[model samples]
Target: MKKVTVTALSVVIGVGLLAGCTTKNESSDPAAAGNASNGTKPKVVTITVRENTWGARKDNFIEAQKRLNEDLKAKNVQVNIDWWPGIDDDELVLQATAGKVADVFMNSSVDIGWERDGGLIRDIDWVKDSSVFKGVPDSYTNIMKYDGHYYGVIQDMDASPVFISRKALTGLGWTGEQIDGLKDRVDKGDFIFSDLVNLADDAKKKKLVKMGFAVEDKRFEGWNYAFGFYNYDADQNKMVLSPKVKDVYAFWSDSVKRGVISEGIGDIDTDKAAPMFVKGEIFAEFARTEFYQMMREANGMKDDIEGYNKWFKDNVVWIPVPSAEKGGKPASYSNPAMIFVGSKVDDEKMPYVQQLIEHVMDPDLQINHTIASGKLPVTPAAQEDARFKAMDFYKDHAYLVSFTRTRPAHPDYATFVQGFTLGVDAILTKGKSSEEAYELFKKEVKQNVPADHVIIQ
Candidate 1:
């Protein structure tokens, strides 16, 4: 829970290293890189971090590295961070295979299975016993593990909920009370998925918006939303083509047929769809909390919870993903950003890597990051921390964690996701029935999923 000031340090060694080299060393003093006059040189350990340009992730790593250096200065060991921003997955895979991967990097929960399978990452089984990782829930850790070995520690948690445009609803003649009442209905299972379709259909018929609903164009994300809405079972540790899955396909197909969903929904990327939602061109869409922050920033609100809620309270409505049926469990999808040590890291550097992991996992530091980034905390301790509970944002949105579920953590999870997306696409775009699509999905899963990974029942 130690805190550090955000000082801009020259963390990048040189621009030339970005062309596929594996080292970038940042030191407090430039001359410290050379041996001291006493014939003793400090050991420099370079920790490479790969992340996208979103959120405060890059800053978090830099600050953590600074703290790490402060902690290790007494031991005569200094840690340098090589920051790689905006590196895509394909490039990361190439780097990893060529033995040029970063020592510690950020990755999605879905990548854990494949990365472990490819032997691109190390197994940090000792993390569970560490004090820094003490209160992290198994639900988060399970998603970052392959088989029974821990490969990463969750950096942040997030949930995807349906965001509604209040202007669109009010334009459709709904009163403020009515709009406010929608959240209660959604929570109590009174506002089912079919109800969403009906509302969107009415809005479309009345021409309240050009599209009644929109979803991310990525098939995997869309399927994840559907999986949550349908309450697809994950406890069984196997992919079961549940009969309930048909309801999900039917909903998409029906919405498309009714012309309530965007025709270009399959092609509408987040950047394109976000503006449409803000302008009231779309009534409702499934999106994450980060998107809410983006909208607030776009509207010129100050970057704080008060500013966000002031605008959200008046202009937008947030609700959980509706259940498939009334009185059923409402659910939503969540995924965690994780940090992993690469397979190529030397044994001599493992302890230092653990120290860096521990520094970032501090509950106070995590709460601060959560406040700045709009991501949920990874540990129960952080969620229950005094600072977290005092924030208006946490007070309002913490209820979402109750209904959030991560995708199944099976070793073939990636394959299952791809197959599910393809099957859903077939039902929506092709002239295929739900039965045919399910059959094709089952065939794909069986053919690709390893036999040992499959679970009966």
Candidate 2:
């Protein structure tokens, strides 16, 4: 158990040249293998694991590590988990390129495909095939793969679903049944995006809230998922715009034109906007339950779990983001936290690494971590736990985990987001049509991203 700071540095290693640089480290000696198979004591080995700053506390990891080591005594393996506070994707990428990453680290699956193709992460499909990993569904495992090869394990995820202020609707003289009806429609795939706009517009007209809806433009990927727009074609290795892109663009543009969405929303940061949501300044917005904790804190209930739970029960309601038509798919997307084995790990330590990852993915450990961190559990067994089921927030949103979609696993994903955001803003504020916005999107991607990397259509 160590704490290390990964400082900002400029470094780039050519992943193309480093591809296939890793080697399997299984013991060649039959005597050693036989001894371990027979439960004979072998020399103890330690593997490194890294956890990000945001998810769970240091004490939680330390306690988990202690328990894990106790269980690993029979296998003669141990883990040294390094807690890296405030290390983001940029720093992690730099560490990977420099061959200085830990054996395993928690990261977002959004970058797994990029990292795999860049030769920064180890091929972990073999670990997925092991008995310890067989319980994880293919839907979750598929997101961690690149070119049909697994590079990571999905640890925890939260769908970016829309949250509505029940208090605001109630203030508009709506009954509980009416509010529940809306939620039911949303859940049953009958409440389309147009219905959302109409509800928000009604709230706006009645002055129930200052803004009817809000979305942070910087993280525009959620809307794409809600709209069922997958931008990348894996078969062709090209970035293809969804045929319904214009319809989604028009939906936002119309929301703005009708004053349901206010001006300057492009600058709305989640940190600031989340409080607005709690204060009932906006009727609905995309968020995770983790932010409901923030809302509780904003309402002066930081440590009062009981009060917070009561507040959440009375004021908040969540639903999958509505789609284009009634009976059409209403979907949510996940940016799942993942466990990745670094490419630089030596072959000899692979056995220990597997054991460490298996322990980390254990159902009890996953349940404990999600409870401590306030994230949705990834494992089916963990989801069925009574503690997880007891929380109204988790129970209400748990269904979202079943159908959560992931973003395109390309290295230039940031580029695609930026390009899409630019196009969207043009339609919303610049008075450009969807066709014009499409051109702007194409130009932005072409100028900044590698040409061969994406086929913009």
**Candidate 2 lDDT over residue span 289-365, tens digit each:** 56666677678887887888987778877778787677777777766777788887777877667666666666677
TM-score of candidate 2 relative to the true fold: 0.85
Candidate 1 worst ten-residue window by lDDT:
1-10
Taking all chains together, each candidate's TM-score versus the true structure is 0.82, 0.85
Where does model 1 exceed 4 Å of error? Answer: 1-19, 29-44, 51-53, 82-86, 171-174, 219-238, 300-308, 346-348, 363-372, 380-395, 409-411, 446-457
Task: Score residue 182 of candidate 1 by CA lDDT.
Answer: 89
- Per-model RMSD to reference: 7.2, 6.5
Model 2 residue runs over 4 Å out of place are: 1-42, 57-61, 75-86, 93-98, 132-137, 171-173
Index of the highest-TM-score prediction? 2
